[model samples]
Target: MRTTDFDYFLPEECIAQRPAKPRDSSRLLVFNRDDDHVEHRIFHQLPDYLNANDVLVLNETRVIPARLKAQKIPGGGRAEVLLLHRLGDMTWEVMVGGGGLKPGKKLQIINGPQAQIREDLGGPRRVIVFSEAITPMLDRLGEMPLPPYIHTPLEENSEYQTTFARHPGSAAAPTAGLHFTPNTIAAIEDKGVRIAKITLHVGLDTFVPVREDDPNKHPIHSEWCHVPLDVVQAIKTAKEAGGKVVAAGTTTVRALETAAHTSSHQNIPEFEGPTSLYILPGFDFRVVDAMLTNFHLPRSTLLMMVSAFASKEQILQLYKMATIEGYRFYSFGDAMLIL
Candidate 1:
């Protein structure tokens, strides 16, 4: 299908500039295909739709302060770098800004470390090798890398993170996980539902606009993900007990579904690798039974994936209702539970 097939009109005011005061206070829109039901509730009400036999899978990948500023050596020009992925102990694939920053050049972070451009990865990306392990200096030099569309400054660094974020590696947050709170998670567990964790470091490609007319022609970027053997076992146990597997976000769904792509043990595989799985409409969903996701941007790969999970027509209809009801949109926005 065409990329424009997923396009819709989202008002500027619908975009949330900051996170909800209390994370769990965010709104939730529930869509159930079983009875064509659509319900409005608070984010904490996530457990109301699931049963004791269900498993809520979440992405534990934490967002790093990947955005950095550097001074060009000799030239002393200002250069900005947004670290995308780590390649080695002191090397990274990054998006560089500031004109005349060709390969084989050098730059130094003020009161921090220095780096040399190894090669051009094209499209604003460059392979850069640092003089020292910049991890220790991150807290001092790095800022929370908020989305470009969000004009407001984040009052706290922890505001963009999920309560359960454990591993630090992502350029972006697994937004669906953002709405979750410790209390809400406890509520789900109290109801006898199991919670499992997977790691998929979100990439900047998530915010990239789909320029292709044909959705299939768009090349999806490979993001590092790891689904442990225990997660596989948890899903197996849940299914054997007649429970549903509900994913917290699209990233969680991608990690779970990609791991199941080459199953050797009863349709479940223990996966640890980078995945470029572009989930389009008609794609077979083997693992995730339901999903808790945020309202997505128009013509985005995320929108396409959710469209495949729930019917595109139904999603469009519910989205219209959401817009009319003044529901927030995007990363810091409200959520939708598709069951």
Candidate 2:
């Protein structure tokens, strides 16, 4: 399919700048395939629609304060570095911004640890080695990197992070996970809806647009992910019980789908790897029965994945309706539940 097929018109005003006051207060748009109907509701009402036998899988991969400030050594000039992922101890794959950051350049990353550019990996990315492990100093030296479209600074950096964020790795937040609060989790659990956590360290795969016109020709970057044995068993139990295996976000869906890639023979998939699985329309999904996700950018892989879950035409119509109904869009925006 053409990338344009997934494109839509969205006004700049619709992009949400701030998160909802109470995380769970965001709006929710429910699309039910069974009834071919759409229902608009508040996010807190999420539990009311789910059953005790259902399993809700969430991405617990935490958002790290990855954006770092630095200066070129010898003669100083402003520089910036955004950590993508660690290559190894004291070494990271990062994007050194402000131009002129060439291989062998020494970058004095203030307040954290000293970082030296070792190699230019192209795509404006670099291989940088730090003087020490940077993890300990992230809280002191790093800042939350918001999307470029969101020009306004958030009141609290933690607002961009999910309540269940535990393993710090992602450069960007698994945005759909940002809508859930501790109270929402409690409500879902109170209904006997089983909750499982998987990790998929979100990466630049989110920021890179599918530039190729032919969507099939677009390359998808790999992201680290892990689905535990327990989670796999829970999903099997839900499927056997005729309960839905609901994914909390697209990352969760991707992680589960990666595991389920070879599940035609196995009852469940127990997987851990750097998954580059790209879901497009007509791709058969082995696991994910339902999903709760935020509205995505047009012509993005995200939009394509959702279209694969629902129909491309149906999702496009739903997006048009959402725009007409004045629903917020993108990360820190509202949500959509496909069931």
Candidate 3:
């Protein structure tokens, strides 16, 4: 329950600097919970391990170009902004970084395409006033806010999002879904494994560390999610047929599990709304039977959630193995499928 319990040593070199040449070429560390076994294989080999009755639930939320750096007018001081979420009617919850642009300061952002600080709650989260709707401005001025660890420049912003990215709301990609290539998804369908999509607009909260030692004491951030009726029916049908429900990412897992809470059946409930469920050890997984996820940062809630899916010791052991074997880590890194 202590935050330190999830800690592990990871060499700096193991943090992936960039994506693999062919996206699906990255390694897959498959963990079978039923037998407590691990298999190392390429990601493209995913279809070979799945079958017709299985259901693959994926998060289809798209990553927007959220980072925008603009110079303050008149004096030309610089300010960095990462748009968190649009609060509609021309308001936005923006994480802006700069000095002097305090509360009530009316500043021109980037040469007449202006904005004003209506409020500054401090520490990166702010409420801003954009002269016009944010959509047009973001379409022109924003850049994808890649994870801080990936220092290289992204010539194409699309690479930061998955190939199947559709809804443009998530600040971050549901990374486990990142490993799947177009061919890989096609192959999965070819094997008769039904693929379903859900939406969980990932936020900075998913990456925030557990500040409390006891997992139950930590607060979680709410994220907007939607689980469609079809995906629900498919999961229900699959379970009835004695097939497993495999979640593609933690985002999808959270969405599906949240929905299942309302179901008359034990594991698959129908749901739609915002969820702040912080999954950790001792949490009963009512819906998901298997999970596909990316390597997470040390002591992160994500790592702890995965630990809950398997045992904390098993998850930590795999992390050590991943580090020693030089498997890439974090958003653009390798993936693991816990079956």
Candidate 4:
């Protein structure tokens, strides 16, 4: 489909600058694909829509402190480095901001190690070699790589992390999981809904828009993901019992579907490694039957994915309703549960 088909108007004021006071206190928009019915509800009431036989899949990828402040070694000019992926013990694929960050240029990370640009990957991206492994020093040297749209600083770094977050690798938070709290998780479990965790280390590419007029021609980047054997067994049991596979976010959906796609048999196998799966309209969804996700940006891949799950027209309509009804949008915004 044409990328322009996914475009919509989002008022600047509708964008949420910060998260809700209590995570579960955020709004949830429920949509039933079976009958095209819509309901407005609180995020904590999610269990009400789930069945005992359903398996809720969550992406447990944690957000890393990927943003770093640096200075040019000799000129002392300021620069910003955003870590996208680790290439080796002391090298990373990164996006740099500021001028003259060419290959061979050295940088001094503020209060951290020295780094040198080793290769150019076009545009703002560069391969950087650090004096030492920067992963160990991220806590002290890096800042939370919050989306550029979020102008206000977070009160606490934990606000950008999900309660289920365990593995540290993602450059961005899985916004859907950001709405869950301990109490919310307990409530869902109390309702007899079994929870399973998978991981898809989210990247800044998730926020990148499809520049191609034809979305099919867009070169979607691969992200490291893992669907463990236990998760596969959980899905098997849930499906065998006639329950739906409820994915917590698009990332989980990707991991599960990628696993299913890679399998030679009927059931999904344990899958690990980089997945370049791109879900568009007309994609055959073999794993995820339902999904809970946050509002996405206009023309963004996230929006396109949800549209593929539901429909382009219906998703746009719900987004408009949410906008008119004052539901927040973006990373710290409200959630949408499609069933």
Scored by TM-score, the top model is 4
Best by lDDT: 4
Q: Evaluate model 2: give its TM-score.
A: 0.98
What lDDT tens digits, residue by residue, belong to model 1 across residues 1-339? Answer: 788789999999999999997999999999998888989999998888889998899999999988898999987999998888989889999999898778889998877899999999877999999999877778788877898889999898899999999999999999999988899999999999999999999999999879989989998989999999889988998999999999999999999999988675556889999999889999989999999999999999999999999889988898999999999999999999999
Candidate 1 vs candidate 3: the TM-score winner is: 1
Q: List model 4 lDDT by residue over 154-183, tens digit each.
A: 998999999889999999999999999999
1 versus 3: better lDDT goes to: 1
What TM-score does model 4 achieve against the real structure?
0.99
Clashing pairs in 4: none
The residue pairs in collision within model 3 are 260-269, 263-269
Give the root-mean-square deviation of each candidate in angstroms. 1.0, 1.0, 1.5, 0.8
TM-score of each: 0.98, 0.98, 0.96, 0.99
lDDT of 3 by residue, 105-206 (tens): 555655335778788776778898888876666667788888878898876877788898889888888999888889999999998999999999999777
- Cα deviation of 17 in candidate 2 (Å)? 0.2
Q: What Cα-based lDDT does every candidate model obtain?
A: 0.91, 0.91, 0.85, 0.95
- Candidate 1 whole-model C-alpha lDDT, 0 to 1: 0.91
Off by over 4 Å in 4: none
For model 2, what is the error of residue 101's alpha carbon versus the real structure, in angstroms, after optimal superposition? 1.0
lDDT per residue as tens, model 2, 222-252 = 9999999999999999999989999998999
